[model samples]
Target: MRRHTDERAHVLVLHGGQQHSTEPTSWRQLSVLRSRLFAAAVARAGRQDRIGVSFLRYAQRGWNDGAPLRDATWALARVREEHPGIPVGLLGYSMGGRTALHLAGEVDALVTAAAWVEQADLPAVHPPTSGRALLLHGTEDQMTSPEGTLRAAERLREQGAEVDVRTDLADTHGMMRHRADWHRLAGAHLVQTLRTSTCDAGGRGAD
Candidate 1:
């Protein structure tokens, strides 16, 4: 993949499984939701024009099934290669959230919703204490229980990582689309998380 303009700090968005082919889709299935969330957060954080967002398309059969953790590392490596000095962040929803977790340490910060992290898939080495992570989930997420996020938070805390979690009070699965109210709440939370990390010694914004 070729590196694009370096005018803005980059965010690589990942989509959940909707097909099994290794081919690209005509339109990203989750672009709207991704853009809305990214836009809201960037605006709130006062970094609207300083940020760039792009999608990470991958091959998969279903949300839960994909190449093992080792294989998925290539994608993260590519992102790092594209922006050698720029800070990278990930915003993933649903199954895409799971992919973010596996690749968390590779980025400066991560914002995930309704994700699950299998122990075996975790990075061999945890991200340094400087790395930051945020997890959000719906209390009524029938597809992936709030427990999934809770469990991930627990593990991260145990490892002395900076991880924060927030759960929507009444939203169900696909909370990102439930209503404008949910979006507002989530958007605010995400903006704060990313903003806080931006000033950390290791959280330098892209140049």
Candidate 2:
């Protein structure tokens, strides 16, 4: 699999669903939107010097019944192999959000927008413990259940994972109504978590 690489801390973004497509044009819009959001967040957090963004495209446009999760795991392995000790974050929208949550153990931080987590097979998957996660959902989302998102957050919390759930009353499943808020929150979380991890690693090494 091909990826965009740079010297700064890496942020891997996964876009929402599209019908399985062989053409690149089908995912162009979502890819652009996810990339811009990550860039905006990094800029807002003054992490332009610390963060580099990459958009991950799945072989299939659909979630593919857990295939995307496996793809994400492979991608994370690749990132860890190439970057070694560097910080890495995962951000996902809609179906991609569910995939990110599933693979949260592999990254330093996670940010999900309207994650379709209620439908995820939670019993078979383990919650994240190594990193923190931010879950953003709208109260009026028509496509996915907000209650479901909250429930997933609760489960993560129960599993001793650091999870923050934010609700936008005026937004929808797409969260376009208050896009800036999403960027600001996500960017801050990414920066904080990565920095915290670095500090913890340094402390351990000093011992």
Candidate 3:
């Protein structure tokens, strides 16, 4: 695992899919992608000083029967070891989103794009969160239907979470990377909601 400091909130970006897409080479590529996206998003967010990003690489695993949760568990353990004082936020794309939700307890906030949902893991409402959960899905996503994210949102809300679900009909699964407007919109909303949630928690703690 490698760490990179930036300006917003300390983030742990988990990458989706294998390196070669066909070869599933351990989690080296996943870690690399995680770091890359973290750097890019932090730069775009213009909160480089407030955020620090890190990546956790693991052994190779298959998509259908992958050890994503196991890898995530290990990754969070490492995060705890290195930066116990920092609140962790997760940004995962596609398969990485699935892993993020599966390991949601470890993060203060979750920003998932084009997440693949499994019925077994589906919460009657959105997944419970101590902080917040943001689901970003493309209305025109051909790979994973927007319905999946909508359902997840429903479950998360039911679970007593402050949830936000946004749809970008014009953006494809990977389109958020190319579309600055979409990225800014999504990122801003996420930052605002996270701060709100954190402030609320602090207020309660003070009381």
Leading candidate by lDDT: 2
Question: How do all models score by TM-score?
Answer: 0.70, 0.83, 0.75
Worst 10 residues of 1 by lDDT: 1-10
lDDT of 3 by residue, 137-204 (tens): 77777776678778777777766777878775577766554456545654664466545545665677
Tell how far residue 110 is off in model 2, in angstroms: 1.5
Ranking of predictions according to lDDT? 2, 3, 1
Considering every candidate listed, which one attains the maximal TM-score?
Answer: 2
Q: 1-207 in candidate 1: lDDT tens per residue?
A: 113454234566665544235444334455335434644554444345355555555544344355523334675677667656556666666666777776667776677776654555444325422456778787877777787777777766777887768785677666755546544544454445444554553444333
Off by over 4 Å in 3: 1-9, 18-22, 26-35, 43-49, 124-128, 176-178, 193-207
lDDT of 1 at 126: 50
Candidate 2 — which pairs collide? none
* Model 2: per-residue Cα lDDT over 174-204, one tens digit each: 6777888888888888777777766776688
- Give me candidate 2's TM-score against the actual structure: 0.83
